[model samples]
Target: GNNSGNLANISLDDILNERVKELYWEGFRRSDLIRYGKFTGDNYLWPFKGGVLSGQGVAAYRNLFPIPASDIIANSNLVQNPGYN
Candidate 1:
């Protein structure tokens, strides 16, 4: 119960690791990494991130989920998300 450590001493990496440990199964990892600017680019990567065994930075547009093809087809005004179409 003694969570009195100085928050300033906590590194971003520590915070990210803790979030991963605490919220791994809740599906927040992607969003968390994205919020920390680690979801794209070379800042962060794990095994198979982009179907590579060593991991790799993905395109920036990957940060947003792609609009469904069906939805775009149904609505001519709807544009497929960049990098998805």
Candidate 2:
């Protein structure tokens, strides 16, 4: 059964309008706020869960993946990516 007839023909603007209506400004608002530098000033760091902290130490430079640990270990000549110790 071709059910395509049940769907209404829609344009990109129509889809965008529907998304704006459903999401109600929440999606783009965050980026707009951040672009104005609002996000950085606030306490934006996501709280690290207990397991992650225990395994990796308190969330610090070392907490981030260290240039993909396997990559760093395999290639002693390659410098570890910055922000990971």
**Predicted candidate 1 versus true structure: per-residue lDDT over 4-82, tens digit per residue:** 8546466889988998999988999889888989999977889999889999998899899998888888999998888
lDDT of 2 by residue, 22-57 (tens): 777578633443444433332332334224432322
Output the worst ten-in-a-row residue range by lDDT, candidate 2.
54-63
Give the top-scoring candidate (TM-score).
1
Clashes of 1: 0
Off by over 4 Å in 1: 1-8
Runs of candidate 2 with Cα error greater than 4 angstroms are 1-65
Worst 10-residue lDDT window, candidate 1: 1-10
lDDT scores of the candidates, listed in order: 0.88, 0.49
